[model samples]
Target: MLDYHFQLTRPSLDTIAGILAALFVIYSVSWIIYTRFFHPLARYPGPFWASVSRFWMVSQIRGAHADKTQRELHAHLGSIVRIAPNEVAISDPDAIKTIYGINSGFTKTDFYTPWRPAWCRYPDAFTNLDEPLHASRRRITNSLYSMSSIARAEESIDKCTAVLLEKMASFAEAKRTFDMAGWAQMYAFDVVGQLFFSHMFGCLAAGHDHRGYIRSLDLLLPILCAASVMPTYIRSLFLIGGALVQPRVMKALTSLKDIDEAAEQCIAERHAQLEQGKSGDEKDILASLFAVMREKGEKVDFGRTEVKVEVYVALFAGSDTTAAAVSSVLYHLMKSPAVYKKLTNEIDEATRAGSLSSPIQYKEAAALPYLDACIKEGMRLHPSVGLTLPRHVPAGGCQIAGAWFPEGTRVGVNAAVVHRNRDIFGNDADNFNPDRWFGPDAARMDRYMFQFGGGSRTCIGKNISLCEMYKMIPELLRAYHIELVHPEHEWTTHNYWFNKPSNVETRVTARATGT
Candidate 1:
């Protein structure tokens, strides 16, 4: 009787499995039908697979071609294209104000949640989506990134710039080829380190990614990109799985953990120094943050974790994007010989006129209209961040690019798409011409340029980045005649979140004075 009962139950288990499988198929079919025809966003033009599921978007992101794909889609589908079931990419310049402008009802989407580390107890300004919370946090930290603050912090930047030039000098002396992108990254990392923690990561001094931090950053981008499009529950599952699965997931986790540990260690050391009666003499960003905390006294709203997150955001967000911008400027300068010559002449004229100093001050560089134009053009052609900055529509819904998007809809502008809009940028939008920025439509172009983002959330670190590039580009060109090793070949880029360049090999020598 026991054997007969067991045999009957085994078939019952199989029956249950069959029922579950049938239900899964039915549910999938229903979801597809609902999203394709019955969904509010179904009327929007998009790829068929994209209209039905987020799988296509995720796959493209994972493949590191999402930016290019979006650009192509926008080119063919006009201003708006449904990249995912709930998300639309807007290429219209006017939509920038509507979606991300000051007091715009659109809040950040859940896409940024994964940006805040799983271990973090609270979100930093970058990861915080709540308007009030972000505003308060931004207010507290705003002065640290203000132009005056950055001007004071120029000493730290100068130090890092010196190290970078020294490294380039060595390459120039040896007549050796080097990866410009790598050196640019080293300079950026060290600059942020010096500015934030009063410590340099030694990437420039050591002549490589000394701490493995850069490599870790490169590895983590694809993971973050994939996580950005996943649903909240699925993303949570990934986090849980990453914690449990030691080997497979640990690789990515370790990279992020290393960065986190570095930040924590820096904070601990700073606290230790404070306990030992060490007064900070340098006007670094950390010093400024500490000052604010002290002013708040017992009512201090933020703590060590908050400080760590801010420093982490500074290092993580600041480094790669700045590096890419610097690299882009150099790449374009090299590609367009006339532009390069014109820029060199301007730098030389400034130097001869006793206007530009050695190591080039930010103010002096700012005055060089041609240099400014070139920087703008470089950023316009190849914006560091290639993905759409996603935002969620408010409860009442709104019109964007002349179409109404319902509440809870995701809408964003991709810099890659917006920067190339022929209507705003002209017919030669694809070309890299610095003169375009000096044209009558220049002001109009600036209005549409989404390189540094827009509105209140505009990158707080924008001044610092511009200061670095403004100083570094002129100084480097004035010192060395740099040439791409393979001028005929295009440098490869991997657009995860930041469009990072690889194999930006170049050979350098001292630039002939007055030539």
Candidate 2:
């Protein structure tokens, strides 16, 4: 009674709809069953939803902080938790070596592909896909990020800090609540500008985001974060280009284009200045980049693109991350008055003893044990990067937490997860207690500190951030007695990827004496 002619191809609308719906259900059920019961990672403990689908992971990210979610997941599921069907978050501090260690054969996942531009076919230092090529890129200009080289620009750092202090003093005089979060961002961006171009970005001087760079990045970051979860660069690019955000709006925002254009303009200007026999700070990043270009360009394959990537990475890394970190130190200090007093007391003692200098030399700040402890503790509680540092397994399988992971598996350790591990950081790790850094575990804790990441891919601009934080935190605390405007409320932070703290309203008053 059934007409089994090729009616399936030309089915009625209702029949077609019914068939499609049925097929979708069948596919969905099949995928869930396979992913949960037969996938290589099926044995790992995680949320029931996560075991069956990646949408669960994406939904959690859409809903809350990935860092906190990951930490809670690890706590519930033990050392390893399947964050997604294809990804696992390892909380074991010891696993850092296996995952991110040099020569570990665990290369970067596709998460970093968006950082590279299409024209620049070669991978720069920060791109995660090509380790060997990027490693070579790192070698060419590693000296530019060296402590000594960054120290050469100490005068520039001092100038930026002085300007920043002047702004703080104005806020103290006005008795106006300081937007410490915004100011920290300005100072960081201005510092990077001075370091690269022999001039500041006018952000600190303007007392707001100059040229809309900060706002643009802030607006686009969520879209970028969402795109990051995509499986490939093309897919992520499509999402950024218009899949998630409107094309016109994305075009209006200057995330990569602004940085690239700035790099191009700066390089062109520098080259013209060079042609005219004008010289810049030899220790400045641009000068060092040029030096490497002339000295080892062919050997290391350094060129205009490499220079741009370096400048791009420096500005991108230095500004937002350093800003967030500086804010963290300030936020925690305001929240925990005891820690604040102890740190300021140390600075006061050192100042009275003439051990501290104006601008607070990096060495001087490094010498203050309590100050150091406070910085370490703040970063531990809130690392800048919230996502797990995902790495792809190589040809041979590797062991982690006593389990063998097959090649090409995605694995990473979230800084928050490891930083708060009770076994490693002790039971009080969840609290902002700086005293944890004073004992025997201090060295071990330092080894596990993923605030700036680990292994060969550790943040190269770390000295810049360290120098800024080490110098500025003590300077601000000693010069101005700061308290939270809303002492009862914690600063607002959204951990889409970067746990950038904002809503930091602090009242500042100038102290009578540094001593």
Give me the candidate number with maximum TM-score.
1
Candidate 2 local lDDT, 1-515, one digit each (tens): 14555565456766889999999999999998998889999899999887776667566656647887888788777899997778888998889988888888889987777666555746766674788876866777787788878877888888898998898888888888977888888999999998987788899899888687777667656655665675553454556557346864365345667766777888888888877887754557788788778788887677877777777766666788898889988888899988888888899999989999987888889999999999999898889888898898788778998888999888999897888988888988889999999999899888999988888998888898888889888988888898899989878877767777789998888898864
lDDT per model vs. reference = 0.86, 0.81
Residue pairs with colliding backbones in model 1 are none
Write one digit per residue (lDDT tens) for candidate 1, span 428-470: 9988899998889999889888988889889888998998999
List clash counts for every candidate, in order: 0, 0
Q: Residue 476, candidate 2: how far off, in angstroms? A: 1.4
TM-score of each: 0.97, 0.93
Worst 10 residues of 2 by lDDT: 1-10
Q: In model 2, where do residues sit more than 4 Å from their true spots?
A: 1-20, 233-254, 280-282
Error of 2 at 240 (Å): 6.5
